[model samples]
Target: MAEVKLHGFWSSPFSCRVIWALKLKGVEYEYIEEDLLNKSELLLKYNPIYKKIPVLVHDGKPIAESLVILEYIEETWPENPLLPRDLYDRAMARFWIQYGATKCADAIGALYVASEEEKEKAAKEILEVLKILEDQALGDKKFFGGDNINLVDISYGPCAYWLPALAEAVGVKVLEPSTLPKLHAWAKNFIEVPVIKENIPEHDKMTAYSRSAREKLGKN
Candidate 1:
């Protein structure tokens, strides 16, 4: 068995974050793709509380939460060094990461609920969050942590992969080249990284999944 194992859902950006960090650090892991609708007993056993994916099992010890798992990967395998060495720089990165994790995530999550007829309002909120990420957080940086992809970049892992399909499904356009120039360029560059490029779920696969999920949500 591989020393490192990741319990993830293929279409989940959270899962992709863990996957990217592991691959970037050259960590060989056995990925277990979960069916969110029918989570496995192993997943339940590993992450008994949250029971959510992006769980990294190292030497049989499971670590839950994507962001938490990411820091673990950085600490355990510090070869590539995802976070900056400087304390202040690392703190800045962590701040941006945590902010998005709390506020932006809450806004984006509203897209999942169907009965909320104010889709545009939700989209506007999500766009405003991205706007801050671009203007205040990201700016003109090629990546979140300057020239190199760091923990901060890894934290925003889902934006590059799923945002396109999400925009399509929801009838919105947030990550567009014209709308968010710097961010759009960053997304392109972020995905081009070899570690990320190899492990991302196929576009068609994710789009199909998103559409299906939306349909199910619409019915209820």
Candidate 2:
């Protein structure tokens, strides 16, 4: 087996996604925790463009971006497939992952720092997104990928863990059971997966971090 090393931060959902994928594949790896504020020389060397966490180094080759690294993992270690076998389902999964990448940040940013009225507006927008996700993507499935959690669920890991903390910090609710029950249930089920449940940051710690992040957003 080739040597695998993961560069990540514990609190980052992006990092957690990579961790979950690696664990699911039963890949053995050395984990290097990077301080986002200081950024290690190895992380700088590996991901020069993004200078980001969650870089996967396999046999001295570096792969960056959580989603890109996920594809690489799936392709490299094909034992436990993270994507569908059918070509079109794989494409759809990628589409939803990309969609989450583009829209999720915007939806979360609304509550990151906003006036009371702004929170209301952002909550509504987030609900709309969740509604679309529940109806079109997740539906009644336990995960986005029917019975199994796949790339789409991994892509939205932040929504599962981070968004609730953010919403709590900002005093807004987006993933309510009443409005978006499927998505709400999906988030619950996603986090409860043994690997995910074990690896996620503690909720109180996340809430504290969310508060700090929101404060920084307010300043900027």
Candidate 3:
């Protein structure tokens, strides 16, 4: 059995982030496809707290949370360095990653669950968040890490693929080319990377899933 085992769901951006990091690091691991509704015994054993997918089990020791798992991967591999070498640069990278985890995620999640009357307001909030990301974090860089992708890029992986899919499903335009050209272009470039392009969930499937999820949210 492989020492590195990953339990993940197909349509999950969190899972995709780990997948991308592992692939970039050239790590060989066993992948266990998890059903969120009927989670596996091992997954529950591994992550008793959250019982979430994207758990990275290395030699029977499990690491829960995608960001924590990502840091673990970077440290263990040490090849294809995801973080910058400079102290300041690395700190900045972490800062943006943290921002994505908090502010960006909250805004996007709000938009996802927004009612018809609140959709526009939710979208505006997300746009404001993205604008900051574009201006402060991204700027004219091809990727957040600049030239090539780093932890910041990986951290914001959902914004590249899942956000667009979510926007389509919700019938709201959040990352528009006309309005936020740089961030829009960044999304396009991020997805086009061979590693990302190959690993991401299908857009149509994601949209359908998002739409279904919204319907379920409405009922509850």
lDDT (tens digit, per residue) of candidate 3 on 1-220: 8999999999988999999999999999999999999999999999999989889999889999999999999999999999999999999999999999999989999999999888889999999999999999999999998899999999898888888888888889888998899999988999999998999998899989999999999911
Give the TM-score (vs. native) of candidate 2.
0.95
Q: Which residues of candidate 2, in runs, are more than 4 Å off? A: 115-117
lDDT (CA) per prediction:
0.85, 0.88, 0.92
Models sorted by TM-score, best on top? 3, 2, 1
RMSD of each: 1.6, 1.8, 1.1
* Candidate 3 clash pair list: none
186 Cα displacement, candidate 1 (Å):
0.6
How far does residue 102 in candidate 3 sit from its true spot (Å)? 0.5
**What TM-score, to 2 decimals, does candidate 1 have?**
0.94
Question: Model 1 segments beyond 4 Å from truth?
Answer: 114-116
Ranking by lDDT: 3, 2, 1
Best candidate, lDDT-wise?
A: 3
lDDT of each residue in 1-220, candidate 1, tens digit only: 8998998887889888898888789899898889888999999999999889978999999999999999888899989899989999889989999987988788777765534476778877878888888998789889998998998888887888787887667666668887789999999999998888997888878877777888887822
Candidate 2 lDDT tens digits, 84-198: 9999999999999988887877776666777656888888888887788789998878999889888899889778888888788888878888988888899999999998999
